[model samples]
Structures are given as C-alpha cells and as structure tokens.
Target: MKKFKVLSCAIATTLCLTMAPTAFAGTATKALSVNTDPSDWDRPNAGNFVASYSAGDNYIYTALEGIYWSPAQIDNYEKAYGRYLTLDLKEDGTTHSLNGYSATTTLPDPKFDFEDDQEDESSTTPGYGRNEEVEVVSRGALSDWTRYNYTANFRILNSSANPYLITYASQSIPPLYPGGDYNNVPGVNTTGPALQGEYFNNFKTSNVSSSNSTKAAKTVGILSNKVEVDTHSKSKKAKVSKAYDDITNRKQLEDYKKKHRDLLDKKTSKKDNRNQKVKEEFTVTFNTPVTAKKIKETISKHNLKASVIYARGINNLGERVTIATTELTDESLNKIINSKDYSFKGFIEIEGEGSVADLNNVQNDAEVYAVETADTESTEHDIRPMGLSWKLEELNK
Candidate 1:
C-alpha cells in the first residue's frame, strides 16, 4: 500500500480549494437582470450566476458584475435579487438582524469534549510532562472570536483506527448586506487548522456544492457537503485472542468446568484474571455456514444491542466463536436460526441476573455444552478487549 504524506500545516489550516484567490471575468456587457426565482439562476441563459456563497460575498459580487450595464439595469438586478445577495458581518453564534434583511447567523465554534489524562502540567518537578491537550490548544491564538478555525486536538479519539471525520450544519436566512462590501465570513471560510490530532497519519478529503430552485415562487438552495477518509490500517482476522476451547460432549463440559472451577467460584475481581466483568465469549455451531454480514444483520434485526466480536472461518475444531457485551437470549437465538434446521451447540458465560435457565430455552435441537458465570466481584468493562475493535472501513465495505 502506498503511504500518502500528511497534509502540510499551511494546507491543513486553509482546508482545501476554499482559500484560493477569487477569480472573475470583466463585468457583464449587458446590465444583468436578477431572477427572483433562484431556481432559474443555474439554468442556461440565466442573467448572472454566482457559484456559491461559500466563496464569500466578494466572489459573488464579482461573478455577477458585468462590464456593460446601465444604472437602471443594475438597479433592477439589485432590487430583484437583493435578498439572495448578502453577507452576515458577524460570525458569532448569536443571531444578527438588520434593516432590509432577515436575521442572519454565522457558523459557531466547533464543539469538543476532553478528559485529562492523570498528569499535572504545573507540577514544578523535573520529568513531569505538560498536558498534551492544553499545550496544543494554547499553542497560538485562535483565528477569530467564533473560533471555528482552530486546532483539532483529538487526545480522546482513536486516530489510527479511522481518522479524519468532519461534520457540518447550516441554516438559510434573507440577505444581511445587500449590495454591501461585506467580505469576511466564518467557519470554513477563514484560515485555520484542518487536521490537528496527535495521530493524524491518514488522508482526509471533503467537497462542498450548492444548487438553487424555485418552489411556490420562493427561491431555495440546497447545500451538500461530504467527507472521505482513507487509512493504512491493516485488517484484523477473526481468531480467539484468549485461549478458549469448545466443549462438545458432556465429559468435556464437566472437565472444562473443573479446570476453571476456581475462576468461576472466586469472588475477587482482577483486571488481568478472567474474573474481570469483560464481555462474555462462547462458540456456536450453525446448521449452515453464516457470514459476518449475516451475523451483524441478525443482531440488528433482533435488537440484540450486541456486537459480533470475532468471526471468520470456523476454528476450535469447527466451532464458530463469538463474543458480545450482553447475553444472547435463547429466544433471540431461536429467531436467528428460525427454519434453518437447528444444529446450534455453544458455550455461554452468564453474568449478573443471567443463568442457564434462559439458555435451556433454545430450540429443541439446540444444545448448550457448558455454561459459566463471571466472578461475583467483576465490574462491567467499558473498553473493548484486544482484537475486538472492528475497523469502520471494513464495516462500510
């Protein structure tokens, strides 16, 4: 796989094509007429066209100006399309209302949450490191009061997994400065950092487009934005990270229970030991081959609220291993294999408020070879276990 270089600080701050100098030809020879119906603005033979307001008001004014046009024609065009050609002088989150135009709103600062890693920045002792979060944020002054264009300090995000995600929102209002030289805008319009995470080792791209149309003689434009991310992360295979065996027959089930007797009986919770309240792992045999996609769909269909942990070709001497945050009820299991000719044999780990009683409710042919409960002192696990974090790229593909 070819390694794409990370975007330079300059390009990252300015985002993409958005910061390029605005270019427009000479003013229209004939005075441009405004189509109050915005839908006609993009059609062939439209008097004058401005690609997008995102390019800022200067770009819009230049694009509509014509080299040859009488004062009457210019007045007619301005009066007709006054509402559509305007800009909000203020970029703050507050709503600004002015004469001859509806209230306008500029994009607000992007919001983010942060958690302090157990380290002190002001500890006057040697070998103490400053908090990465605070250092990155205070590196330089934010671009503007709105603070839309700033650093992307992602100390809380897992970048190597799937970096470069962007979200945007917008609302429409009547023109704020019709025929006014309002140049500055906020959000994607200003220059600032685009990718500023600790592990920004991936390629991120975005595109923005706009379209206008007339409905009930009212003008309306739809803006569409998209984000694409590509990473060099490798695909993880489905294999039991922690050693576990399949208990097929009654004797093996008994032997397995005896081997793990202390772990099942002990009440002490330890992070490294199997006594932790982590996810329950097991193996299930199906009447027919099932793909990872099918397993995911089944979980969603039944509202299981469970995830497919490890899934690939059969292993453990032909047992399909699976793990989930919640217990898989026999009722859901039966529905999953409905009319598939039951060959469902598996092992289960019951946690608080769960028991073999519900596991016994599987289909008539279903067989549960072994069952074990987690330690009494085990606490619910928040972080996913190793090899369980699925790649979003694979899921999308």
Candidate 2:
C-alpha cells in the first residue's frame, strides 16, 4: 500500500478577480468553462483538469472535464478499478463529497493519432475524454454572497502492483504535485484482484502520475474558484388546518365530468354509461343486533334508493350485520348517512363513483370503523386512482 500527500492552494488571482463577489449575489450565474484548451484561462498549465460551476436558486452545479485515455487505457483501468470521479465541495468551511460517472456506455476514442506519428508526441493530446456534471443542494437555505469552494479528482487502480492498489493524492512532483486543497491521497489496494478478460496486463504506468519514476501516474487539477451564493432565504410558515366548510364543496363526479368533458364526449362516453349501470354492495354493521326490517325502513325514511340484499348471522360480538346494494349517487348516500338517527358502523363500496369527502362524511355520520371501495380495490378507498386514470385518459385522448 502506497500513500501520497494532500495539497492545498487558493485559485489564481486572475480567475478570482474576473468575477466580483457582489456580482454573484442575488443572481444565478455559472463559473467559467474548463477544458483541455490552454488558451482559455490565464493559467494555461491547468488544462489537464478543467471545471465549471454555477449557482441556482437551491442547488450548486459542478462540471468536471473528463481526461482522455486510449481505449486500451480505459479498458485496462476499468478492469483494474471501476471508473468514477470524486468531488470535494467546501462551503462555509465545511466539506461535502459527491461522485459522478460517464452517462454513456461507450466513450469516444482519443482525438489525436498518437501511434501514426511519434515525432509529434509533444503536440499530441488525449484522444478520448468524458465530462461529468452534478447538482448539490445544501441541507438548509444558503446565505446570499457566501463563498463556496470546490475540488475535483479522477483516479484508477494500480493493478501493476502485487497486492493491486489505488492512489488518492500524487507524491511531490512540483507545480502539479499537491493537486489542490482538499485533494485525496492515493492509498493501499482497497479493491482486490483484477477479473479475467480485463486489459490490466498491458497497463501503462505513465497514465497514473506525472512523477519522474517509471511507475508515475497521471494527475490533473483544475484552477479552484470561490463561488458566491446569492441571497435567497426561504421563510418557515405556520401551518393551519383549513376548515372543511371553508373549502368549496363540489360533487366529485361533477368535477370529474367538467375536467374531462372532451374525453367523456369523444372517447369514454360509452364506457362511462356502462359504468353507471353497475351497482355496488355496501355493508352496514351495528354494535348491537338490529333487524333487517329496521335497516330497510331506515333507508326508506332517509329517501335513499337502496335495497337490503341480505342479513348475516350474529358474529362473536353478537352484532347484527346487513349488506345492501345501491345505485344512489355518492352525494345522495352521504345525505342519507348524515340523516340517520341511530349510530351504525360500515363501509360504502362504490363500483364507480365516490370521493374521499363522501366516505369521510359517511364515517362521521354513521360512526364507521372502516370504509372500503370496490372501484379502488383498496380497503382505505383512495380516490387517486380514479382521478389519475381520468386525467391520463383525457391527456391521451
């Protein structure tokens, strides 16, 4: 297991002076783009590792320009160690870690033809590369004009070693040695043996650092920048429950019909008509035994069009239970339940129509222990499925 030292350095003054602290406040902005091109920034030496950053209302975005390796190198590196980029974000003196990878299966090959012309080795550039972008949101609201610091690093496994190893930070090699502040030091072989068919046998040590040793691995660092987050504070609100009466009470079916007029008229009119003919069975149970005749009489008293289908034998608790079928609208059923004089318990299992409010009203008026819906196929009688289906059908139609 080999280890390297961590490096730290402030970004060049030229890059920092380009953007003012006040200019980034109260505004969403992106940092300068980073790439292999040397002429893009004042520090042309930082081309190996380029980065761009932006701050939005709630999140900070960071993009790392990918390093190019020959297909052979990628194949061998991926075989020895998995491909991944580690990001270290420093905000208000705290460090956060993030990871990203290539979004695509196959990466483009190196752009320059290194094999055809050995004489132009100095002018040759990476032929293949990748770019990774990640968005990070703070746990709490970010303060406006707050300075944020960040560093990015790329790594691979050193399969050439007997134990197999990976490096985090490069050893002292000058200028690019320390990498940057918050840099990771390469340590012992965390990952075990390499798999068969992996391209590790022909591994290239030059790909690991820029050191003078034959075992040196390639390491690059971007010009670190201080990003100022704009002032945008979110205020906490006191939660108050709105009274049910304060809400505009509209019939569930009417609301559905109004929202899907085009769909009902064009596509589902026939299906909707068929659904209207399907009646559903509802069971009303009492804590004490009540006669079927009494239940039927009660229905008639409330002006509800419901018929007692059957009455069941007394349960262990000696409570009377009756099942009834109804084609009455949900509003009508709610009205009947609200008008009941005696306390009862039960569920309204409607085949096609009903709302949560309707079921709630029934439970409140009848002291129901549970409510079930056949249309929803759920014991809790959720109306979301019906609403979702209606909306999707309307959209598709």
Candidate 3:
C-alpha cells in the first residue's frame, strides 16, 4: 500500500494574533470580527483531495482562529475559589462567566492517585491551570472545506484580550491549496502490507515508512481498547455494614447476599431488555509523536470531550497520541464516519471523521458517524490519497 505523512507542528513563531470585532451598519448587536497579518510561519497541510470546478477568483478563503482552555484545568482552578475561572458557555442561551488566568496565582490543588505517588510527593503545583495560549491560522472559509491552508505553534498570549468562546464564525476566503495535500510518495514501511486494517485490533507493533518527506522514519501506531464498564447501582452493602451491631453479624451478611442477588437479577434483566445494543469504542492513535497541542486538537475534532493523556509505555505501542472516546453523541458519530480521520486512521467503523483534514467549519452537519463495539485507530504513519496532517484547523473557518 502507498504511504505518506503530515507533520503537526507543536511550535511555530511566525503567526500573529488577530482579534477584531465584525462591524454591522446601523445596529448594535454583539458579534466578533477580525483582520490579520501573520508572522513568518510555514503552512501545514490538511488534506484537500476533492476537485473544485471553479477557477481563479471564484472563491475567497477567510481564516478564523480558535483557542482552547482545558475544562479540567481551568474549572478546577475556579472551583478552588468557590467560583469558576472560565466562562461556562451554554448552548442553551445562558450567559457564561470566564475568569482569565493569572500567572502568579497559587494552584488550589491537584487530583492525586495515592497508589501512584505513595503519598510522598506534593500533588499541587504553582500555575497548574494558568497555562493559556492561542492557536492561530489563516485559511479559506469553506464549510464543505474545498479550499484551505493552516500554520500552528504553541503560542505566547496576546495579553490584550480576555479569552472568549467563539460566538461568531467568519465566512469565505480563497483556498490555499486547491489540489489538497495529495500523497507524493509511493513506497511504504516494510510492515505496511503485513499490518493492514487489523494491526491495532490485535495490539500488534508495526512500522511504516513515509513515502513523501525528505526523511524516512519508522512509524508507530497507537490504539484505544474497548472500554470495560462495570455499573454500580443502588446497594445496601455499605448501609448494612454501617449498622455496627457486630463485625461478623450473620444478619448483615444475609441482608447483603439478598440485595446482591437481587441486583444481579436486575442487571441481567436490563441487559436482556436491550439485547441488541452494542457498546461502541472508537480509538484514535498517533503514528507520529503528538505534542500536547495536537492531542487537544484530536479530541476537539471527534467531540468525544477528551483530555490529553500521557504516560510512557502505557498503551504498549505508543505513537504519541492516544485519544479514547469515553462518551460520544450520535451526531459526532456520523461526523466521525465521514471524517478524513476515520478514513486515514483506519477503523472497523468510524467513531468520527478527522475533520481537520477536510472540514472548514462544522457550519451545519447533515450526517455524523459513530461505532459501537467497533474500534477505529489512527497512526502518524498512515497515508491517504491526499496526504495531510492536522489538529486545530477544525476550529477555524
């Protein structure tokens, strides 16, 4: 099989921050707008394989920028103060409140795993949630995403604006690469053919070489496993034990057994009622080493509500990214199916498409894809007909 690679840049310095409010004639309505001049930065490719019939001047591409603050990090920071630091924007038309991060503020606390730290290390750190940065880009604004280009890097704060959630979306600008990032090379890794579709399914280690770049490096695949959900329902086990009549009271034990058996039967009945349903698990793996920024990008694209998880050798075969879907919406599922991420990453079924590849803005989604009990995986090395690498382009127009 043919192979190629797209590199996701973690650090870029050439892009400039552009935040302007859109203007409307004779009206006072709340909206956002912008104009920009990006600094020196190279563009990264999001695959554009589809053919556009329009010629020059037929379309104009506009770029939008989206920045993300960790929900866990920021919310926790605010929770410690008995108030949240970031605006909790509600799609239900509720106003949200967001407190900007302060660089010098002390962290409230950090979640601790006693088993991992053995209680010796102080889990809290200074500025744990104060890590705020911007992701900027200029590209063709196409909802169907026929034209676009992008540049990214870990950013320095603009310092002039308070962070805000996207309230408005920009419209069309001309596309950057009309033809998209078509696969330029042909030969793949030695293991390409041998480790086809089922590679991640079996948790096997494999290698594939890039058919495009100037350098040839071995690629590793990362995968997410099927989740094991153990439901805990209302139980009297703790209540009975708390009675405190005696440590070995037979009545307590008897009460527990009766309740436990009833629960078992209840669980069995529920499973039996929904006999045809399957639990879906979609896994996203990186073939290349993913940076903290790209991991956030992957989660946002899928809408799985993911957080970046890192631990050396945890997944057995680590490719730098491991985005596991703990929860998914039906709409997100359909999007996953049609998504470039779904196709490029390879999956038994799509959990969600990797839209940063082809999607301009999720202006309006007609279909979304998700899988149940089926697994999908991504790797840094996987090549597509239009070779591209992406993470944040999904947020902008």
Candidate 4:
C-alpha cells in the first residue's frame, strides 16, 4: 500500500535552443527538426497502484516554427489572391502517422491569442491575414524500437494553377528510450520489475486527436491531413432484418422464429455465467494491410484463448491505415489470472520483494511482495513510502 510518484521533468531550454532551425524555400522558409532531446520527457510511472515498466517516448512537445514572411507579403498575397496557405506533415512511414495523432498551428500575431479572440468585439481580420510564424505542436507516442522520418510541407494556394505542395524540411526521429535490462554497470539502461509485464490494457490512442486541427484553415491559417479510422460495421439488428427479409413462406418464418428464440436463450445463459464463452467485437487499425490469417496467428501467438470468429481488413481510398474487425470468444482467464486487482481479490502485487516501502529504480536485489491496495487508499495517508532508500553513490560508478 505504500505510495510514491516519479515526476517527469520538462525538457531543458538549453537543449532545445541549441539546435538551429533548418531553412526551406519561398514564403514558408524556416523548418525545425523533430525534438528528441532525452531530458526526462515521457518517463513511465505507476498509475494509481499499478506500475509500468514499458519504455517509449512521445512527441507531445515537438513543435515546428512557422513561416518568416513579412506581414505585408502575407496581407498582399491574401488580399490579391483571396487564398490561404496551409501546412502539412508528409511522413515517410507508418510509425506516427497511423496512430491518429494531430497537430496544432499557433498564429504568431499578438492581436489574437491561439485559444480565443483577444478583442471583445468581432473584426474583419482574417485568421491568417497577418504573416507570422506557425507553431505546430504534434501529439504522438514513438515506439521504443521504431524510427520515424517525415517532412514539413506547405500548401500554397494558387488561383490560376494547381495548388503547390512545397517540401520545407525533413527530419529523422530516432528511438530515444529503448527498454532494457541492466548489466550491473552504472549509467547503463536496465529494466525494472514493473516494466516486465503489462499493467493495464489502454492500447487505444484514437480519442487523443486534436480539435484544433479541424479549425486550422479558418482560424490558425494552416491545414493538415485529417487522420481518421472508420470502425463501422453491420449491427446485429441488420443481420436479423436480412434474415427476416429472406423468409418467403410461413414455414420459413416459423423456422426463423424458433432459431431466434434459441439464440436468445443461449445469450441469456451466457450472460449469467462469468466463465462462459463471451464474444467481444473489436477493431484494430494497423498502418498497413494485414491478412485474416496473420491476425489469427498474432492472436494465437499471444496465447489468448479467444477464437477469431472473423477478421477482415476494411480500407478506403488506400489510406495510410488499415482497419480490421475481429470477434473474440472468452479470453477472461488472461485478465482474471494476470491482473493484480482481480487476481488477488483487490490487493496489489508489488513488483519487487521485501516491504512495500522498498519500491525504487535501483532495487536490483529486492524480492516481490503483495501489498494491500486499501493501505494507500486509506484516509489517514500515513502509509506513504520514503523515496529512494538506495545508496546514491552506486549510480556514480
């Protein structure tokens, strides 16, 4: 029940400011590389009482500087041509693009704040009327072992000719944090106990898309490729309707009714049993096309008890992502046996051995222990563990 927190420090300004912005062509001149400075961003911690040993980095703070064009150039172009320029991230791989992350471009003008209009009353000022730097902050989590390469492209609106997509700059993002095991050397990367297993199963990042990207063209004066995953499928009601429509006679109708009644009875029985074969419909969107056989193989490789009733890829217009639908039958045993909360009747299993107070990064020799989750949840708050009782000098070698 002992509790502790490891706060991830913000990236030091000294590291960010040192890199010079790369230059591009035309009005969209300046380009910045994806920031991968390893100063303490994206560090993992134990959420609530469950610990995580997973190692991955994120581009949450990765920012791209805007155009350096003068205000007159911007106003004259907009006034004369009646069009706006936009920015887009042209990625070379599926590493970050298919993850459903979005970016926000902040206007450099002081008259309007990024979130809301600075003026109380409305004005005729177009969002991108003034030429300014566009700061695009992208939200994406990079895999520990994957490398991402991409370029910043600007779309220039042309009244007479086809719109131009100019590549301003490009960058290669390397893996900053690869999870590993210690070799008994100081300053060497090592894996901890909590990192060895999956703590929680929140494997989806689709809901994290930015709302600002929707209003970019009108307000922020930029545009980005809309990242979306279509997860639609025919409902059970549609199946029933189709079956009813196919019945042409009284005998067929009676047969369908009896089958429906049997199905309802089976479902009722399954609902009442916790260990029954429960089917869950799930959709997994990958960056590339994958066969149903491949999906089934992956499920079997993971040792999941559920059978893949059906798995098929549904992609549209050859998008960068491939959406696949799957039906899984009862895999509750994995959750029931592995999860700390459900496994031990709500008690948390600490990763390391010894007392619950000995949880630390340097506990290379500590053993595993089971601590009551209620101890930390108590109102007294007196069960907190002291931080890092390990010897500090051992890390200096």
Best by TM-score: 1
lDDT of 1 at 228: 17
> Can you give the TM-score per candidate against the true fold?
0.20, 0.16, 0.16, 0.17
lDDT of 2: 0.22
lDDT of 4: 0.21
What residue runs in model 2 are displaced by over 4 Å at the alpha carbon?
1-58, 78-397
Worst 10 residues of 1 by lDDT: 96-105
- lDDT of candidate 2 at residue 377, scale 0 to 100: 28
| Number of the candidate with higher TM-score, 1 or 4 | 1
Please give the TM-score that candidate 4 achieves against the real structure.
0.17
For model 2, residues 298-377, the per-residue Cα lDDT tens digits are: 34443332321211222233322222222233432332233222233332221122233333233343422222222222
Off by over 4 Å in 3: 1-333, 338-397
lDDT of each: 0.21, 0.22, 0.20, 0.21
* Per-model tally of clashing residue pairs: 7, 18, 37, 6
Candidate 2 Cα deviation (angstroms), residue 369 = 39
Q: Give the TM-score of candidate 1.
A: 0.20
